[model samples]
Target: MPTSRFEVLGAGAFPMLVHGALILLLTGSIIGSLRKIPADAYGRFAADVVAWGKAKRLVFVVFAGLGLYVAVMPVIGYTSSTFLFLITLLVTLAPKTRTALVVALVLALVFSFGLNWLFAEVFNVFLPRGN
Candidate 1:
């Protein structure tokens, strides 16, 4: 069953729904533009998508990691969940280099700490600490 935006977002869903509708409108316009493109262009575009997909197995890994991270995050604590999420996403999305891994680690640490601090200090929201 599809969740209602109201159920998920509380009162904020009204604005979010407006944004979502605008995005759909924009997407429709893009599709219309694409349809006006020459048939040869469309064929080339399709080929490009196929070639890109074949070259980047990383796409699969990143999407799978995102799905898993969403499912697992609420069950675990934020720190552990975000760490796993960042590492997996980075490994899948970027080149596997020592510098890349280090950058990802730093980014994950900053994101986790800043987000946690913002919620706790500014918003007075307390996230679960599974430990």
Candidate 2:
């Protein structure tokens, strides 16, 4: 609901401003930490960066999947989208084992349907529906 460039506040403005401030604080903290590292210990920073690089692909995939989930929720409805997202995320992150897979599937179903039921029946706050 922002109108003018000079406008300081509006609906959603507070959360947006807080999010930006948090990002800035995190960036500042990372910079400060890196600065405190001695020049001779630069290898430590490089090693950390390398470790992050190795995991960057998985991170990107998870974020991209989340974006797709948000975009499709209105079309597919909340229950289906939530179930799919949870299943995919759980399988992707969990250890590769039969027990782990079974547990992930069970958890995904419970969370997706249980939360939907709770919201609709108890809280009386129905999420968006495709039908």
| Candidate with best lDDT | 2
Tens-place lDDT per residue, model 1, 1-131, is 44566566565667788999999999999999988888787659878988898888776777878888777777887768877788667766768899998898888887777687889899999876655
Candidate 2 residue-wise lDDT at 104 = 96
Q: Which stretches of candidate 1 lie over 4 Å from their true place?
A: 1-56
Span of 10 residues, lowest total lDDT, candidate 1:
1-10
Q: Which candidate is the best by TM-score?
A: 2
Error of 1 at 23 (Å): 22
TM-score of model number 2: 0.60
**Model 2: which ten-residue window has the lowest total lDDT?**
1-10
Q: Give per-residue CA lDDT, model 2, range 12-118, as digits (tens).
A: 77888899999999999999998998887776878988888787978887988899989988998888998999999999989999999999999999887888899
Please list the C-alpha lDDT of all candidates, in the order they appear.
0.80, 0.88
